[model samples]
Target chain A: MSVGASINARGLTKSYGSGEGAFHALGPIDLDIKPGEFVSLIGPSGCGKSTTMLLVSGLEPPSAGSIAIDGRPLTKPITEIGIVFQDHLLLEFRTAMKNVLLQQEIRGLDRAESRQRAEHLFARLGLVGAEDRYPWQLSGGMRQRVSIARALVHDPSMLLMDEPFGALDAISRTQIRHDLEMLWLETRKTVLFITHSIDEAIGLSDRVFVMSRSPGRIVDEIKIDLPRPRPAHLGEYPDFAAYTKRIYSVFEKLGVYKFD
Target chain B: MSDQIAPVTSPPTPAARLIRAGWLWSILNSVLSVVIFLALWEGLIRLFDVPVWLVPKPSDFLGRFLVDYPEILRNALATSVTLAAGFGLGVVIAVPLALLMVSIGALERGLYPVIVFLNIMPKTVIGPILIIWFGVSPLVSVLVVFLMCFFPVLVDSMHGFRAVDPRLDYITRSMGATPWQAFRYVRLPASMSHIFAGMRIGIVKAVEGVIIAEFIGSSAGLGFMIMRASSFMNMELLFCGLVAVAIVALIFNALLATSERIMMPWVRPR
Candidate 1:
């Protein structure tokens, strides 16, 4: 039996409070993500990108919208979705290996299998020696690596990353981006990454969804026809610059970016 | 570039080394001062022709206690047992009460004023009432000790639980952790320092509690021994009793400090 999954959202409206104190953070909009697609949501701060990711990950319920993952309505527990927040969010007391193994505990996988999977992922992510160390002992980049390893340990078909590398230095961010794209290419798991950087959206995404501020809605979707196993130097390419420029123009037109 | 490549392991600076050595020297100095104090005390008693009942020298106090060592030991054991029981009871009550305060805002609001009122009310004033109700028994002494030491533990634990990082709580909840799981994993671990802080204070207060209990109601502990010595104007025995209580309190505090170091090894030293 094949366990195939795709995420679908329609008329997804989220409003905080009611009556005189009503506030709409996100859409009465619709979104559909096909299986094995890398989609990036790019917008200004407070544009509800994080909220959208939360809603899609089944972490929060939509007020009016319905979400169906793998054609099944997302009412019950979802075992095949992994989420990464801006902070690595690893349990400080647990070792990096144990942190990765937590996904296995959550998914109710066997201990031996979980350990094997965690070890394999840790090694694959260049975290071999750091496995026994606690989160506090590791650097920021290493902690983020642990988070990615944790997300992949359960072999989740869908990965939701909310600015996963946003807190890192420029060098670490670029390196992680390269590694992430490589991982995505190898695994072909459906990924929804949210970011504020147009360059990042263009660099890593197969398709970028540009969102507007206030009541967040997808203003435009730009397809990047970038080839597989994307080179680190791809950012220097005219085509990549053109895609970023176009996205920036859309932000500028939406008055979200004031490009002086 | 060569300097950068070389792994340079620097030794402690002379100033830092001096400071580290200074602590040991100061401790030695303190011991010397204490010895001088006792010798002077013994000499003054001998020279001034002080009465044995009023101020028996350190030697006399030590000689008498050593000969009657078994009796003193028995009383010490009784005092220790009562102290341990009272301390244990206070811990058992305080931890859950702190957790309750942390969990229920309404309950905390309702109880805060009462706790504040009770904490300020003199334990000495309550002593007579407790003895009257429970009688002059070991049980009453233990109960007195418990009452005296309970609030510090409760207040400290409540502060610790409340002090957990809100961001960490948010992270745990977003990870699909249940409420109990969040408390167990995040809140409880984060509150450990605060709990330990309360425990350290509680232990010292527990010693005070035992003495207070013994003074007012019980007849078998150091407090009662001191009271008896005072009645007969036996200042040396009274001083001996006081010293014994100080030693016990110091030992308890040291144990707590050691345990805190073991439990929270990651906590940066001030």
Candidate 2:
């Protein structure tokens, strides 16, 4: 029971608008994520990866499906899940320390312990001097790292990130990806990550779920059998390249070769 | 493979360059503008031999203002007190009212239009009515300032709260924050810059409202002094009263700018 919680979503679907303009954003599909596994959902735009993330995080209810975490039905937002959006979304008035402690305030948890934990998390995220810095005072990369720190401060069992590094430059993107990989290795929390980049999916995920567009659903699932504590540069490895090629081939089938 | 790393010195942005305009230059430009305006005023008065009764020379106005400084200061203080009281009350009331309006769609439908209707009426009509009700007491001046400040704040707060990033609001909900906690911790701070901007406008309006109230009913503020001096044909005193009003406006503005800087240090004070 104390192990990282797994997600089981059955017949999950999401539809927007009404009548003639009705749009099915996500699937009548089934998905399962095992405990302590790192799963990546990679797809083209409008493949409903974000919609799927929202459903599992319990922020949005499915049109006709059920999502249970560790065999328990999740009706609303539970404390065991942490989510990071694309933007930092830090309160400009608050410091990084205060922003991280916002989770504690929401849950009415112990302040002193939460503050101690927040500081520890910040240090772990390489934000050693940023605890007192306001969001504007930090650079874009630093701000993004602070956002990651805020999400992980509560120490949730499951972490859902929707393209957290999507907004960064090439250099920062590579750097943050390395940081994320190391963090995941140390924590081994059940992570469900969404990204549009095939390389990011193949580089970080143990299991990658490739989705199809136009009433989005999972089309293919690939497991990267690369060894744990893997090499720093994923592209240098032949097996990583093989995994990436297969995922891109799925995109060609779906006619999403634009970015490939 | 080459081990050499490239230097990462990025070019400065245009906005960063614009902010490099020094404070000394800013102050010098302002002072030069005032000097030129005073020179023109002095030249016109002396050349036209304008009657002191109709348009007192700048020299005459300055001298008389200095002589009547004590009386002017008293009236200015009285007017400022009213403005402060009203401005404080306006923010306290309007922020909560706006929170109520934005949080519940039904209440917004029921009450927002009525609020708009009340705000649309020119305070000129409302001033006399308020004076009639409160009757020459200091309370009349306070009420008018409150009325002048109330609408802008209510409208601005409503806009700010409603315009908060929905994604950020979703974060609060997912974090298990109560609605009140969300408003206090997230929505209110998110809209702080807008709220302060509204308060600046409210401060200016509060000053105008108090003067109007004083002119219409009371006999204890700069507006009342202006009226009294004009009726008696003491042109210098009238000029002095007007100067007092200008000084008060500047003081109020400076105070607000200072507080804005203190509260939102992220926004470099302009």
Candidate 3:
């Protein structure tokens, strides 16, 4: 298992175009995620949480600011990481197993070892018997699981998920959230999970950073003291409810919800 | 719930049975319709005492088809060669050209309007020009066919390449995929169905092109044979050539469909 790398961002910002037509997507925000920590960037639509995740992964260069991974400045894309998008994004031509093995194929990892890891991941993600099936053959949730398996198959030190379960049905989302939490507990890879769901952020993250809408910056950060493998009925816990209320209040204060 | 429903192991339902036997039924239906139409044509021609020069009876056409089998086969071989050569060249050139144009924005900008202008000009018009330039040779027919086959494949290929979801690039990039790896693993495979679709259209256009080219300038081919038969007023031979061209087109389409199924097994019906 690869040990997680600490992700540090200083004054990270992203802008599209320039001058009069410029769109400020993200902020001159500073973020520090400890190694092995599971952090969630929770925000509303267009809050730039996704931008922050992309910048951290170094998939896109920040318009301005700096990012360092494991104390090393990220000059190019950080390849030692797995990313999951809301869309399953499985290569339709590849089988569910082959989709996961794509990482190994591209990265030139040990084929035998990677295949074994993929099989293990398949089982863990409840994707057994689905290895040979194409993406079109799988359910929404099952497809998402395959993508998650692909992310973990390479055993990257960090995982970046941008609303990985956003497209799933409610029940599937709950089940997958539970499964993801279990996997994270086992691997303990530094996770930067971006989501709009407060419950999901609070349910899974070690720390949740709440951001305001558009030109999004972290407005508040809340640390969850919830127990490991958190209870399904998180609303029952006073502490959990308090965390939820705190995040909701932050959003409310930002005028996300308005009452006349 | 999985995208596919559970496989039916019990007795097949009425709908399931119909679907299971659908292809066979459709083939039988088409054959029956053709037979009925032919029977009607044969009867009407005989009753009217129609001259063979005007319109040969189905019997005479089939008779001429067998009697002149060697000659018809020779001409068909010529046409097939032209079709294959032209279509093959078109695919080889158009697909790569499309990839280049799509990969390079400047190339797309510089070349797309020129391509559109060329495609807008009628292929039949190009046939005479090609003949004038290349003389009465097989190369003229092949070049005409190439012009007809190139545009659709190029346009559709560009469309396919552009249609790839941007997020897929992000996923592949995170996997340490180089630009070439990303294209090979993602873009190329993703664009395959579209490429095949373009090839299908291109092949049909190629058939039209080859025949027109042969009509204009070719010394041989089914089109050339038809022109020759018409000059001699041998309607039977003319009909035979027409049927041969139709059969050849059908065979080409069937080959294309089969290869498409083989190449894209994921799209195969369960």
Best by TM-score: 3
Of the candidates shown, which would achieve the greatest lDDT relative to the real structure? 3
Top-down DockQ ranking: 3, 2, 1
Which fraction of the native contacts appears in each prediction?
0.03, 0.39, 0.58
Clashing residue pairs in candidate 3 (N, C-alpha, C atoms within 3 angstroms): none
User: Tens digit of lDDT per residue, candidate 1, span B120-195?
Assistant: 8876677788888988889887887787779999999999888776655444544566777777666777788888
Order of the predicted models by lDDT, top scorer first: 3, 2, 1
TM-score, cand. 1 vs. native: 0.85
For model 1, the local distance difference test gives 0.79
Q: After superposition, how far is residue B29 of candidate 3 from its true place, in Å?
A: 6.5
lDDT of 2 by residue, B1-270 (tens): 011112333324434533443333444665688678878988999999999999987788878767888998899898889888888999999988988888899999999889889899877577777777888878888888898999898888888888888888667877888888988898887888888878888888888898888898887989899989989999989988887887688778767765765566555323
**Stretches of model 1 off by over 4 angstroms after superposition:** A1-4, A76-79, A105-108, B1-60, B165-181, B261-270
**What ranking emerges by TM-score with the best candidate at the front?**
3, 2, 1
Superior by DockQ: candidate 2 or candidate 3: 3
Across A1-260, the per-residue lDDT of candidate 3 in tens digits comes to 89999999999999999999999999988999999999999988998998998899898899999999999999888889999999999999998899999999999999999999999998888888788877887788888999999999999999999999999887788888999999999999999999988889998999999998889898999999988898777888899879988988888899997756
Alpha-carbon lDDT of model 2: 0.82
